[model samples]
Target: MLVFGHCFTKGNYTIDAALKGLCTEEEEELERTMMAYWANFARTGSPNGAGLTEWPRYGAEEEYMGLGVKRQMANG
Candidate 1:
């Protein structure tokens, strides 16, 4: 279902005034999964699945996805 990347991200990008670009493949995979989930949400108001939590629109005080800053890194 529609899930927020925060549900899978458990690391901080910075600590102690230090800017450490900590990125992991596992995190990237999680991000991808979350993005796909959102695609389903966009097409339909609800995500199709069993036992999945209901996804609500942001600003609605309900159990749903929450968004944080999304940034991209360049390797080329």
Candidate 2:
């Protein structure tokens, strides 16, 4: 399953500011990106969305997107 946990996203602390902290442009952009991903995933089976990085296929690499203040891809 996709891990949107504290270790993945900005962290649990940000939850407290979820209602008020999206004031910055970057924060708003990230939120919009996340919402789009979720919406597309709900409509289709894939989480792909416009302007989002290509989600790598599950394989031996074990790669995933570590979404946070700095969104990036990681392998474990």
Candidate 3:
């Protein structure tokens, strides 16, 4: 299982900010995307779904899916 810090960021980029309802549209979308990714992974073995970017498999490249204000792939 992979662990990430997607849902841990929000308006204030804090845990409390994530739980509150004062998040911006980007923050809200980030939360939604993260949830969908996790839900898809729960239903299937992979996090890739109909509209999401293909989550790359972890390997020597050491890449990861970034769930920040803007969604993108990043190298770890």
Best by lDDT: 3
Q: Compared with the true structure, what per-residue lDDT tens digits does model 3 show for residues 1-76?
A: 1123444553445565445555566766776778888999899988989888789898999998877877788897
Question: Which window of 10 residues has the lowest lDDT sum in candidate 3?
Answer: 1-10
TM-score quality measure for candidate 3: 0.68
Ranking by TM-score: 3, 2, 1
Predictions in order: lDDT: 0.45, 0.65, 0.71
Instruction: Please report, as a residue range, the 10-residue window in candidate 1 with the lowest summed lDDT.
Output: 67-76
When 2 and 3 are scored with lDDT, the better candidate is 3
| Backbone-clash count (model 3) | 0
> How many Å off is the CA of 57 in candidate 1?
15
Count of clashes in candidate 1: 0
lDDT for model 1 comes to: 0.45
Q: Report the candidate with higher TM-score, 2 versus 3.
A: 3
Off by over 4 Å in 3: 1-21
